[model samples]
Target chain A: MPERRSQRSIGGLTRRQVLGAALGAAALGAVGFRPRTAGAAQPPIRIGFCVPLTGPYGSEAQDQVRCAQLAVREFNASGGLNGRKAELLVRDSKLSPDEAATRTLELIENEHVDFVAGSLSASVQLAVNNITKQHRILYNSISQSDAINEPKDFSRYTFHEALNPTMTTDAVGRYAFPRFGKRVVFLLPDYAYGHEMTRGFKRVGKEFGIEVLSEIRHPLGTTDFSVFFPRIRALKPDVLVCCNFGRDQQITLKQATDFGLKRAMKIVYPILLYTARLAVGPRAYQGVVGGTSYYWGLEKTVPAAKQFNDRYRAAYGGRVPSDYGAFGYAGVRTILASVRQAGSVETDAVIRRMEALHYDFYKGPEYYRACDHQAVQSVLIVESKPAPADNQFDVFKILEVYGPNRVHLRSCRELGYS
Target chain B: MAALTPELLALQLLVGLALGAIYVLLAFGLSLIFGMLTVVNFAHGAFYMLGAYVAFAVAGLTGNFWLCLACAPVVLGLIGYGVERFLVSPLYGRGIDYPLLLTFGLSYVLVEAVRIIFGKQGYPFDSPAALAGSVEILGNYFPLYRLFVVAATGTIVLALWLFVEWTNFGLIIRAGARDPEILRVLGIDVGRVWRLVFALGTAIAAMAGVLAAPLQGVTPEMGDSMLIESFVVTVVGGMGSLGGAVLAGLLVGLVVSLTSVVAPELAKLSIYALMAAVLLIRPQGLFGRAGLLG
Candidate 1:
C-alpha cells in the first residue's frame, strides 16, 4: 500500500467536508431542476386527423387534410405551441365508421396524439366520438351532424367546429321563406344528415307558416332523379329545397335543368358545397339562393380571414379553400391556441382554455361555447350570381351574414349538455 | 295529395322507359357474356366505369361528345380482347368458378387502380349542346337528352338483336355458348369466337357507360351499383338470354319508377323482391336455359 495522503482543508473546513458540501449542492440542483421549465426545449404535440380518404368524400377530405396541414405549418412557423412544434398525424377513414374508429384509436394509443379532428359524414363522426370519449382525447368535429352536440350524443371531450343542421335551417330558412315564398318541396338524401335537415326545415317552416308541399327522400348515391321530378313538377312548389351535396347535388341540378323544373320553381340547396358549385358549373347555380358556412369572399371583408386565405391560396396552387377547409384550419388552430393558453398539453387544461377562447379563423370571429362545445360563428347566406369577368371562383355574392345570435341553437345548459 | 293526371302518368311511363333504356344496354352486355362465355364477368361494371372515364377524357381533350361515344366503345373492345387473352382465356378450361373469381378480383383491381389515378372525386361531363334543354312530349316537358338516350339505346339493341339472330358468326357464337365441344368438333375455331363474343359484350357495356356518364357523373364507385343492378336484371330476364335481358330491364325499371311514387323506399328493394319472386317461381330465370347457372 502507498503512503496515505494528508487531508486538505479550506477556510477551516476539512477536504472531505468541502467535497460533501459540493456534492450536496449538486444533488439539490438535480432534484430542483425541471425539463419543462419556461423557455426550454419541448417535445412535439401531435394532432390526429381521421377523415374519409377513399370513398366518395375523399376529395373533400383532401380539403381537410391540406388545411389542417396548413394550420400546423402556420402555427409552427410562428414558433408553434409555446415553442414546441405542432405535429399532425393523418389517417384515412375510408368513409367507414369501423375504419374511422380503428384509425382514431391507433392515433391515440399507438401514435400518442394529444388531440384529433376531421370528419365529413355523421356516422363516421359518431364512431370517432365514441372512441374519443372513452379515451378522453379531445375531438373537434368538422361534420355538421345535428345529433353530435345533443344530450344523447354529448361528450365532454368532443366539440363541433362546423355549423349544425339546426343553425343551417334557421339561417337559410329564415332568409329563403320570405323571399322565395312558403310552398317548398324537399329533395333530400335518405340518411341522417338529410333527416336532420328535413327536421330543421320543418321546424323553421312551422315557425314561418311555410307549407311543405312534399318531402322526397332519395337513395344517397342515386344517379338519376327524373323519377322524382314529375311529382315535384306536378306539385308546382314555389321552391325546391335541395338538401343534397357532392355528386348528388351536381347530378340532380343538371337533371333539374333537363326537366325544366327551373322554369316553374326556384332551385335552392340549403347547404351548398364549393365543389358542388364548381362541378355543376356557374350556369347551373346562377340566380340560385343558398347558404354556405364559409366563402373565400369573406376574406375581403374580414382582415384576419383575408390573411389566412392569402397564405392558403399561395400554398395550395392558388386554389381557394372551401368552408370545409376553413373548419379544419379553425379546428387545429383553436386546439393549438388552447394548448398555448393552458401552457400544457393536458386534455382538461386545454378544454378549459378552448371553452373560453374566441379567435378568428379564415372567416369572421368565432368562439366555442363552454357547455356544448358548439362554435358560435356567422352563417353565410349567399346568392350564386354569374361569376364576374375577372374572377373564376367568384361564383357567390354574399347576401347577408347571420351572426351566432341569429343562427345558433339554445345554450348547452338548455340543450342538456353532459 | 293531388290526382295522378294522364299527363303525369304518361310522363312517368316515358321516364321509366328512358331509365330502362340504360338498364337494357347494361344487362345486354352482361347477358351476352354469360350466354357466350359462361363467365359471370363480374368486372363488367368495372369495364363500364372505365368506359365512362375514357369518354370523360376523350370529351375533355376533343371537346366532342360524339367522339367520346364513338371512341370509348372501340377502346374498351380492344381492352376486352387483351383481358380475355391474357387474364380470362387461361381459365376457360377450368370450371365457371375460376373465371368468375378472376373477374371479381379484376374488378377490385380496376376500381382501386381508378381511385389511384383519377381519385375519388367525380369529374363533370356536360351533355352535348344539341341534347341540352327540354322538349315537349305528350303534353309534358321531357329532357331531350333522355330522348336521345332512349333512341340511341334502342338502335344499339336492335343492332345487337340482328347480329345474334341474323349473322352466321352469331350462330357460331350461339352454338359455342350452347355446346362449345360441338362447335369445336365442327372445325369452327370456338376459341376465336369466344374472344370476339367477350369483346362484343364489353364493347356494349362500354357504350352504355359512355352514354350514361354525362347523366350520372363519372365515379370510381359508380360501377358498383351498376354491377349489382345489372346482375338483378340478368337474373330476372334469364341469364344468357339477350331478349330476356331487355324485357327484364324494362320491367325492373317500371317497377322502380312506379313504386317510387307510391313508396320511394321500396324502389331498390323492389328489384331484389322481383328477383326473388322470379327465382322462386323459375329457378333458371325467365329466359335462362334449364339446368344452367341459376
Candidate 2:
C-alpha cells in the first residue's frame, strides 16, 4: 500500500493526476476534438485579407481581390520571388473587426500562412492589428486607417500598402490647389477614417494657403445626404470636399447632385473620381474633379502600368478596373519584393525585406512610407470629359499627377520605428 | 448654418423622398408579419438579403431581371415557411423568448451560410437596362430606378392592404390571431395559417429586395438595418393591426426623410430615437394596444 501510494506520484505530474485524467478520459471516451494545422515544410505564402467582403464595403473587396489575384499571377509568371512560384492563400475578414481576428486565425493555424493582407475597410484593419502582431506574422493593411500608424497600436510586422487619409488629403491638395484652389468645406465619414481625412486635408490646405471653412462628419452607412447637403450648399465653399468611402461615397454624391450642390458649388475627393463613376454612372459625375493614387485609364507613360491595365482590361471583360485594382496589384508587387529579398517564406524575414523595399513600378515617383508602410504614389487630378464620345470610362480628364515628393510622404522610421 | 435656399430645400426633399421610399419597403413586411403574428418576426430582413442574392444569382444565370424578381419571392417564401413549421412551430405555445431566440439564431446562420457559399465577395449584378439613369422629377434629376422603386412599393402596399381586407385566407389569419385556440378548435389548422403567414411575410421582404436590386449594390448585410427598423415599426404600429402598420411605415419613412433633409448623419438613427421617444410617452407604442401584450 505504501509503495502503491508512491507509484501515484511522478515528479511534477502526479500519477493521481494521471489516473484522474485517465478516468475522466474513460468516461468521456476520447472526444477527438483535435484542431488541424497547416503542416510541414511547404509553408504556403498566406496573405490575410481583412476587407468588408460581406458587409457594406463588399464591392470594394471584390475589386481588391481581383487586383490581389492579378498581382500574384503576374509575379508567378515572372519566376516569382526568389524563383519560387508565389502563392496567395486568401482569407476574407467580411468587414467586421471581431470577425477579422477570428477569420485570420483560420489562415494562421489551418493554412499556417506566411503573412496577412489588410482588406478595404479601415475598421477591419484596426481589428487585425494585435491578433496578427501576437503571431509575429506580417499583416499588410490596405485598409486606410491611421490607427495602424499611431504609436500605441503600430506593429513591427505590419505594413500599409494603401493610402492613409493624410496621404490622400495631401495628394489631393497638391493636385487641386493650384488649379481648383482651396476654399474648402470637408464632408467626411463620421469615424476614424473621417478624422484622418479631415486632418490631412486641413494640414495640406493650410500649407498651400487654402482656407477650410468647416469640416462635418457623418456616421458610416448613412443612406441620406440631406442634412450635410443643405449645410454644404449653404457654405458654398470653393471645393466641396467629400471624404466618404464605398457606398456612402456613391449615396452622398448622388444626393449632393440631386440637391443641386454640384450646380451650386464645385466638388472634389478621391472616391469621387472612382466609385462615383460607377454609382451615379458617368452622366451625373461627368466633369467632377477629384484625386486618387491611380486611375484605370490614366494612360500611363510607364510601360509596367500600361501593360498591367491592358492585360487587366482583357481578362476582366474589357471594363476598366479601378485604382482599387491597381493598389491590389501593386500590393502583390510589394509582397514579391519582400519575398525575393527574404529568400524564404518565413514571416519575420519577409517583414525585414518589406522594410527595405523601394520599388519603382510607375512613370511618376512612388515610395512606400517607411513610417506606416504606406505607399507614396502619384495622385491623378482628373476632370470629367465632354459628351457621349468620351463617356465610356472617359469620365475624367488628367489635370496633374501629384508625385511622391509632391505629397511629401513619411516612412515608419520617421514615425519612430525601432 | 446653411441657408435653406429654394434650390437647396427642393434638392433635400428630393433626396429625402428617394431615401424614404426604401425605408418604407423595408418596414412594410415586418409591419405585415407583426399584424398577423403576436410574436415579432426577426427573420424578415434576412429574407430581404436572400431575395437580393437570389435575384442576383438568377440574373447571373438567365440574365433576366423580371424572372429573378418573380422567382426570388417563391424560393424565399418556401424557405420562410420551412422555418415557421420546423423551428417556430414547436415554440408556438411557449413565451416570446423561444421564437425571438430562434429567429435571432436563424439570422446569424443565414448570414454565415451566404458568406461561406459566396465567400463574402460581391458578385457583379448588372443593373436593369431599362432603369439605368435618372429622369427629371420635382425640378431635379433623380435616378429613374429610385422612382420605379417608390412607385412599385406604393403599389405593393396598396395591394397588400386590399388583399388582407378582401381575401378569405387573410381573414382566417386575422381571426386566428384574435383567438388562436378557436382557430384550432374550428378545424381550420392554425399551424398552417402560421406557416403561410411566415411565408407571406418572407415573400413581402423579398419583393422589396427584388425591387431594390438595380438601385443599391446587392450585399449580404443589406437586410440587417432594415430588420431593426421594421421591428420598430411593428411595435409602433400596434401589433396585429394592418392599417396601423401602413400608417407606421409611412410615418417612419417621413421621419427618416425630414430628419435626413436637416441632418443626414441622424437620418438612419432618427427612427430608433423616435421609437424610444414614443415608447416613453406610450409604453405600448404610438398605435400598439395594451390588450395585444398578454
Q: Whose TM-score is greatest here?
A: 1
What ranges in model 1 sit over 4 Å off? A1-43
Compared with the true structure, all predictions reach lDDT values of: 0.81, 0.67
- Give one clash count per candidate, in the order shown: 0, 12
Candidate 2 structure quality by residue, lDDT tens digits, B220-275 = 67778778877777666656555656667667776776665466667778888878
Tens digit of lDDT per residue, candidate 1, span B111-196? 98886667666677888989887888765579888889999999999998898889998888878887899888999988888888
List DockQ for all candidates: 0.29, 0.25
Q: Ten-residue segment with the worst summed lDDT in candidate 2 chain A?
A: A3-12
Using lDDT as the measure, which candidate wins? 1
Assess the local accuracy of residue A151 in candidate 2 as a C-alpha lDDT between 0 and 100.
71
Assess the local accuracy of residue B125 in candidate 1 as a C-alpha lDDT between 0 and 100.
81
Against the true structure, what is model 1's DockQ? 0.29
